[model samples]
Target chain A: MTSSKDTEHPLFQRIEGVRQRTGRVRDPIVTQAHGGGGKAMRDLIDDVICGALGMSAQQIQEDQARFSLAALAQYGDRLAFTTDAYVVSPLFFPGGDIGKLAVNGTINDLAVSGAIPLYLSCSLIIEEGLPMETLRAVLQSMGEAARAASVHFVTGDTKVVPRGAADQLFVTTTGIGVIPQGLEIAAHQLQPNDAILINGYLGDHGAAILVARGELQLETTIESDCAALHGLIAALHDAGITIRAMRDITRGGLSAVLNELAQASQVHIAVDGTKLPIRPEVQGFCEILGFDPIHLANEGKLALAVPSEQIEQALKVMHAHPLGQQAAHIATCRPTPAGLVTLDTGFGGERILEMLVGEQLPRIC
Target chain B: MRFVSEFRDPATGKKVLQQIEQQLRQLGHDASHPLKIMEVCGGHTHTIFKFGLEGMLPPSIELVHGPGCPVCVLPVGRLDDAIAIASQPDVIFTTFGDTLRVPGSQKSLLQCKAEGADIRTVYSPTDALSLARQHPQKKVVFFGIGFETTAPATALTLLQAREEAVSNFSVFCNHITIIPTLEAILADPSLRIDGFLGPGHVTMVIGLEPYTFVCDVHKKPFVISGFEPLDVLQSLVMLLEQFRQGRCFVENQYKRLVQPQGNRVAQQAMQTVFEAREHFEWRGLGSIPHSGLRLREAFSAFDAEKHFAIPAQQVADPKACQCGDVLKGAIKPWQCKVFGTACTPETPIGACMVSSEGACAAYYNYGRLSTSRKLEATR
Candidate 1:
């Protein structure tokens, strides 16, 4: 072990040597040699992953990260763990890339369950012939997103396959979080007369991806609403608002989340179409294509059910944050004979909103 | 959204609704014996159900959904041909999005696609032509189906392919005209329709001149109406006024997009590429003479039917479906025995329950609850 005061340790010198050797390849492209589990693989990881993540020599050499029991016991008594895989086409989009989506998506899975996200593990599967610069950029974005969410990438793995074995890139992120001692939130805790609220506008992520594919040939300035919601969620907790249930609106959009909640609690949910916070451009796109915006996907939006009296305080706290500017009260829960969802149209009629039978837009995430 | 929003204003719709009510009252029409007006366009049926226009109007004015939806009227045999073509290894089959789910005798295009078929959804026929240009080694077949509103675009696409010398592109033409279908509905002895709201987009292609027969022979008022809440309401008012004065005439209420002379260039393109078929099979209406179009002899090289051996035999509709009675306005959608029981949007047993614009689907999705409530009150 090197002393804490020693600035010129052999480990630091070896890391510096690996960095210098990687700098020699001016126009670097990944090849079979880099994935052979030999010196070439070490150099690629040292130059791209370690360099972008700014990992210490000891942390990089270790096989796994060990967390202390005392440190975890400070937050709560239970641990929340989740894992998600992201395979979005057109690796780069208007507001984010696959790396940021992987990070935020994992974090949101834990945060919506009333857990404070603490650690993440990132794994990458790269196709041979991808540029080294592209790998570096994605790693840098992941590091930046982790930093913004106050989480750490304690462990990771990388593998490269031959060309045509996979797409350009695919990422899988697993997250660990701790639920506070007093918080008990779940989808089944929803009660009748509870208020349903959303964080912001819907369908931005789905619409942005559709335009980014260049297949629709539509011109719009809509950007993906890919964001981490821990800050907004923590604020609501700090304000002493009692939340019964919460869910992130992701792949199946607001409709899927509400349906799941309604079935779980055995309550009926009725949402007003006029109250849904949808941008005009997104609505216009759906109108032209004969799609329903309710069935479209969203990334940063969340659906929360709380007591009717606390809705005002929840709205006030959410509006104070940057991510929740378009927060709205969308629906109310009722105790009907059957668990179903009804949408009161902006016109004076009502209809039942059901889960989509088939894929409305394929490869949306 | 400028033109769209103005036509859906609630205030404008209410005023027109009041005028329609007054005309009905002056003509002595009551709820016990209602006036049935058939809207001959699927687009109009969608607007009516989507906006809840049925509940807003008086019970005396009943809007009967007609057989104007091109997707709803497509026969089972034609869909079977599409599935067979799409299943071929070297062929790239393309069609509109809605046609992918219409059931055939065996499977739909969507089901074939799941089994490793190269089926794609395109917004226009030109997209299929471009696919042909991109892949010269593969054959691209476009399933051209719709009313007259969509026939011209397919015709123009075929002409463009010929001009560019794109040999891999072919069209499976199933385009149908609206006039003969309307004539078939009028000639049915079981139908008791009082007036007709003509299709708007079809009128934009072939103008109001073709609709004079509805008034001349059947002595029924026909109004070429737009597909909007206010436009439908205003057209109803005009039809009621005509009934009150005992005047049978064809009128125009969608002047914003449609003109008296129609689009001549589109008509010329359609005429150059297509000719009337001797007889065509409709899903609910049986076989009608001169109701469908086929590629002309000069354009046979670009016809998919000529290049491929398709099973062109007629397959009857499902046994328990009353789609014929529903299309001809002889019965309400709920009156059908299989309606909400054996037929639904998720598991459609009939063509009328497959498309969103179809009468059965629109009612099942939006109007079923209100209709059941009315049924309960009467019982």
Candidate 2:
């Protein structure tokens, strides 16, 4: 017993050290010193992502002692897996950051999959020689988000690289959660008579990111709705309604996601632009931006599909939840010719929602 | 919404369409004397495409997209200037995202960004102020690009920058006034354009007086139209009526939004901040006198030109590209040798193909898709 335990302790420390060094040197913007694999890599991790995030000593430890399977035992069966990368130009923004975005994004991926998020595996690739205090702040924010979502960080991998190989810092989080018993949801499972519903307005996240990065010049204040949606999903499931399909409106916003679903299910999605609740400030912003709100990204929102008959029930339950209070029935399922997301314009014309050909704006494209 | 929605009523739009149709029939469908009319603004082009106005118009009333969309017309040399400024160690370049994809002397702003340049896309002029305040040590140059509609905001920003005395902030002004460009197109004998669809916002600022050139010198009809879908249709109807009556004058279809004299305070601010450059380069039409603005000498400190020594360089247009003919309304987009072949939207070789407001882009987005149905229709 003494021989095995003692051998494993040092082995764990060595593995942890390797993981830390790797995260620093493999950063998108790498530097010569990061490749040196000496003090530079440690400094990179300590300064950029980990330092700003301010993780506890336990979290910083490079071992599996901090994790437990019981933490994710809430949902007994089917597991949901999702991962996302955060590469916003500006490291910080109004109302949130990469840390918060990483946490919320992982949780939403599971939530919209009809799963109760259980645990997350965080991976960070940070640039070399960034400030220590900035890294600490980011870590603290990530820890707060994890705690708020009631999810545990069970495992993680870190990599670092030389300067100029990456942006300031990028965090990739892969989440695994368990789907509740008896819950069956699939994109192709959507029936022709299914109704389309949205939690709230679109384009807030994309617009906020634009404003935060100082890319757009407009006379409006907009903020990203970067939030975890586990609470809202729980409320919806408890309302005793069967869901056909669900998805979070992310990168391509509502339109891209809707187009994907419509193509998958071989049915039509007709969105009512007028009924879709849009913030006046966001709308005013879109007018000058030449950006449609529907094609913008929404972080703290979800679109759900349910039978037309169950729409009233689903809407009532969504209304009861704070996150879903602004939820609206945006469209109905129509027998469209196999595949298309048609938008019924305010002027009584129908426009096809074409798949995004290129990045909406090329700076990020 | 209040000022924009009322003009798009279907019932009224139908009436205007009917009136134009009747007038066009009276003019007779003569190919040699086609009633060619050019909507001389990018905003109009966008409206024309969005509403499928070309398909709705009479056969004789040929609607040509004019030299509008400043982003589309911004030459590669100026883009290179912006790229040079953006690549500077202590300079942050702010521009619209549309400008980033535009090629500049073998490089684009997006490509520069990929090379670690501090290029940011902004939606409004004020956003540059924040970047300036945040990066005090770095020079923040707002690559000001747009037509007169956007000039007021850019002017206000320069005014604000001067008042604040933000040493690190400057504007690389590319704002081209619309009047001379219109004049250049109208004076050209080859165009033979019957009437002009005047710009609404430019009219809002400089007022209807500036467009008197069409009536006085060019002797062509000018109808100032709002940007809405129905407003464009109404303007066409008005132009056709003027043609039927053998009248050459300026009419206003966007009376609610535009006035004879625009916002005086805004114009006064622009006058204080900027002055007309003796001559400015247009992408397709070459150099036009008094078409562009430079910051007044008094506001030189806030002008990027005062700090940087980048020389303005003239670049030759790509050979066989017919952007000049297109801008002059002498040829349609389809007539260009590279219109949809070597110069498709994915690989745009000219400004007209790049900008969303560009005539080529409008044609590609709205009309090109249905080309097979109208293969033999367009001249």
Candidate 3:
């Protein structure tokens, strides 16, 4: 049997200790006092991620580790910074929770930007009176995930609000990394003839969380694809291929990101709908739930804009990394009215991609 | 998946789009006088908007959204009824999320909830039964809403409630029928509808026969369509062809799901559960005779109205709101003075702006920007 844990990223080791602070089980829900600075924050951090994942005291205290951030540097520069917030509902989901999501999300953002994640600062707002155990479990997961990624626990801030003032627990994370020398990535770097590549299937992460929450009934079990991607980034950078802009497909999913990139670069991206690597289960869930996969969220996934010639080299490197094993070339760039993403659908008609508005699956991270 | 995937197929979609475009051009329509068709189903409106269907169709073919959303068409009196039941200290009200935002005579159910009333938005009707079982001390009233498509679930729920002998469970049934509303729309002079894109799911329940009322009375072509891009494009083409030939008839293109008589088992369940009320007031259409359903006398114990002393009074819509005209397909949402200003989705003044399936809501979400874009592209 293949254990899924073996493919863990190196950044995980660095951030394990900091995550140990929030995992504690007290009452059923989170409390605003947990977010308050000082002992309260410490209690929350210990109760949630730290308590849930069960980190050692030594790992919790030292909070220092190194990751490969050199490859992501642009124009001889070395630092890359990224940040994101989690506002998912039913805080605890099937495969993961906001705690795991926060760490993985921040790391993924930095990874895709060609940076090797090194450290993170998490800020949390807890509704007053939230149970100690839920906070502990969240912290535990954060520590486990941080250890898996080998990212260091640097610093964090916490705040607490009155009951009902906060939605259980809300986490904001800022991740910093050192980009490797000579690699400059920007959306404008996407050329008309570049190929569009995806790390894996679309909509898995979104649908998994949705199904786990029972928002939409499906026959299969789908779990959130929340994981740190810095390892895969390292592998790709070593493979020595020119990569343009890369982005983690999160809220608004592939459609939102593609449209944003197209608009920014003044290029048209025509993705063959059939070429999309969506799981049958995800597709079924989307159809029954009346949602579009292109607009669904994916945590441990990204799209790469690279010259057509470098596609093979990128694929070889990506395949060696567990996170990028299922990666596929989904589409190619074309010269059209800039700022347009068109799908030549499976049925042979074209539809212009629009940014998804409102939450597709509420409470789905 | 069967109904959804087939319609989304690119090849099928292209065929339908090509056929619709060819038919539109063959009609030699004058660009000066564009063809306007109003889809009467809220579900249809949602599908149209979600896929940006308006952007796909030719400029000459303009889809004017209708007030087909049940939540959008729920009169203020119905909300008043729900609120009165929920506000009762002994009662816990349950409804779909859309209905919670519908303004009652005084305030919405959400406001009532904020004021300490027990109100919950349930994902399915089955959950209400669990609520009834859990809260045996309090009255549980499920705010039963939706057109024919959702009626079966409500019917089944009522039957289950009785079989389980759940005394605390009762239903505030606000279920409406489709045919009478269509008849009312035909009689209205304000709506100059050339044709209608019939509702697919409701037709799946009531079948294609009832829509004959639309064809015979209104002298307009009625096409039952599935909720897919291809299904919509095909229906549009069929309606265009009917108009060009000066023919009016009820046609069904959603053959896979909808039948002439619909599912007999579901209909039998409904027949056993409900009977028509003499007159029911619709939010935008006013009181249409024999248009609403009440729980049958056999199930009187399960009816909240029979057990509770809730007041039922006619409530007037806001004077500045033209949702009535919009629901009747008589006027466009933009024609209403308060449409974009006072009656936007954020602060919706009428039912049409609240429901996800509401015609106005659909336009606000998918059509507005696309329409503006089309105008700019043409210019």
Candidate 4:
């Protein structure tokens, strides 16, 4: 039996070597031939995907990775799954690119749910004539982000369309995570008197992307706050703090997230404008463009609702982490006047923070 | 943020609030009949709501949002004319972002854009000129809309286009003078505004001499104010002091920015490029003589009205909308029947409900909840 097993292993090893030797792509630009179902496609995949992601020979050969039943049972029966598509114009920005955004975005979605992100499936749609260097840079960014977050990309697919049929490139990431037992966190779980905390300043990502677009023609030093947050979340749990709900402040920003929580939990959220963390530069950018910072987008920052009793411990844990060095207590949930978010202005007035109707556009006058 | 932070200091704001209260007390004003001060600039209205200045004021003082939002006062007929020009196949229509959402009789620029119209939002007319330069094959028309503050920028851009010989670039000039609009407001008997908080930016262009009419003819106090929380509060104090002393005169509280003679070069550029229209119909207030500006005969080649054949037909305001009353400070925004029910930022029924600086949009988005809470607390 030992002799038979050794012979089978050598046979598999020999097949992988032959495949690797033959499947080496040389073209510097993506073309229709790279996506066609032939040797060219295999060569492109082996050179671009496996080389950049550093996939093992055995892992690259499998259609999908399989896990043992015993390993899956340790994290409980619930699995968290989420998918997101990244299509930022300009493809690259001050601090991150589309590939990094795809990885961090999906991981954040799962992380905010109190789950441990484990695996991700990447899919790329490449336009013909895209330079290989750009692809390599993007793939390298994705690989580094995945490694930093400690998640594995076990499977992926690639398709090449005609030039102008798509943008230079687009990436979609689907992530799966495991939720531990006895842990429940959801938007609807927010209770009255819960403390609302933010991990850091808002609008950095939005301001950075806006400047990177080159429309404003103004210089800025702001960088996108795109990052994974599962490690900071784990630290919070380790601190023995009970987290009721958490949400990453993205597209519509802090105002949107607060409104969502208010509507889901049927409570009122009163945010103090002075207490909300905002960088001076971001504030200046919004001032010139006539935008409200609360409505601006964020990437790495998150809003958390913890029981009043555990807020102190949660804040301590958050402030100790690198990502949460600027953590702040922004607001508090109230039992009365359900489904509303109000801001106590720094200038001493109260106003309702509503979800914006459409995109916030710069005012000329 | 240096110049900005000092004007927004909460301590200074409180001190100004106390002075306003003291002046009101000297004038024997109370909540029963609050002293209504109309700030005739959308920028001031925006600052008031953004900083919660209204709530910080004494109940004896009331702020009346005025018809200073250029987007809010654009007649629907003019918007339709703009849309008609924008829908042409070879035309690339450009406008400020806030103006894109203002509804015409048939459709808004946003809706037209979604249906494949080439409407782009530009920060300034210069940006539109750049687009024109890039797309020489397409006819570029800029919807130039603003008061005197923005008119100078549009004028300068047009002058540059002429110098560069960019034949494809033209402007649909809807620039209105503030003096005429303010005069129209004062002439109205329904509006009980005791004093006026003049627009700082506009006065920086037109100068203080033009606003002296408010004091000379109407015997009403007018204070040129800056667009900051402290500026607004301090301006209110100035206006109240005038009321307390029974004086009606023009004061310059924004002296740091606005010169007595205004910006000479900007004024010169405007004169070189534009001439007053015979009459221009305001959205809420009816036609005022020589209120709007049009390209001069020398610059007719760059006039959108003359370049394109547009249907310049008159369309009446929605009957359900009381924006005229709102603009004239005759009624508060919430007092309008369809404020939150039908006219909202999402589905705006009036121009005032569309722009961010519009009184209705500001009240709807920021003031409604707070006002209700204040009522609840009082109860």
lDDT of each: 0.87, 0.77, 0.77, 0.89
Q: Mind giving the per-residue lDDT tens digits that candidate 2 earns over B246-285?
A: 8988888989878778778778988998899998888888
> What local lDDT does model 4 show for residue B7?
89
Q: Cα deviation of B241 in candidate 1 (Å)?
A: 2.7
- CA error at residue A22 for candidate 3, angstroms: 20
**For residues A114-218, what per-residue lDDT tens digits would candidate 4 score against the true structure?**
899988988999999999888888998999999999898888888999988899999999999998887888999888999999999999999999999997888
Task: Identify the candidate with maximal TM-score.
Answer: 4
Q: Could you tell me the lDDT of residue B11 within candidate 4?
A: 81
The deviation in Å at residue A38 for candidate 2 is: 13
Quote the positional error of residue B268 for candidate 4 in Å.
0.7
i-RMS for every candidate (Å) is 5.9, 5.7, 6.1, 1.2
**DockQ: the better of candidates 1 and 2:** 1
TM-score of 4: 0.95
Ranked by TM-score, the better of candidates 2 and 3 is 3
Say which prediction, candidate 2 or candidate 4, comes out ahead on TM-score. 4
Provide the lDDT at A297 for model 3.
Answer: 88
Per-prediction TM-score:
0.91, 0.75, 0.77, 0.95
Question: Which parts of model 1 are misplaced by more than 4 Å?
Answer: A1-40, A53-57, A60-65, A159-165, A361-365
Of models 1 and 4, which has the larger DockQ? 4
Could you give candidate 1's per-residue lDDT for residues A1-365 as a string of tens digits?
55765748787888878765643334378887777888777777776776666565467688898899899889988899999999998888999998899999999999998999999998889999888888788889888999999998888888899998989889999999999998988999888899999999999999999889886778999889999999999999999999899999998788889999999999999988889999989888877776777888887989999999999999999999998989999999999834788787665556666667566732110
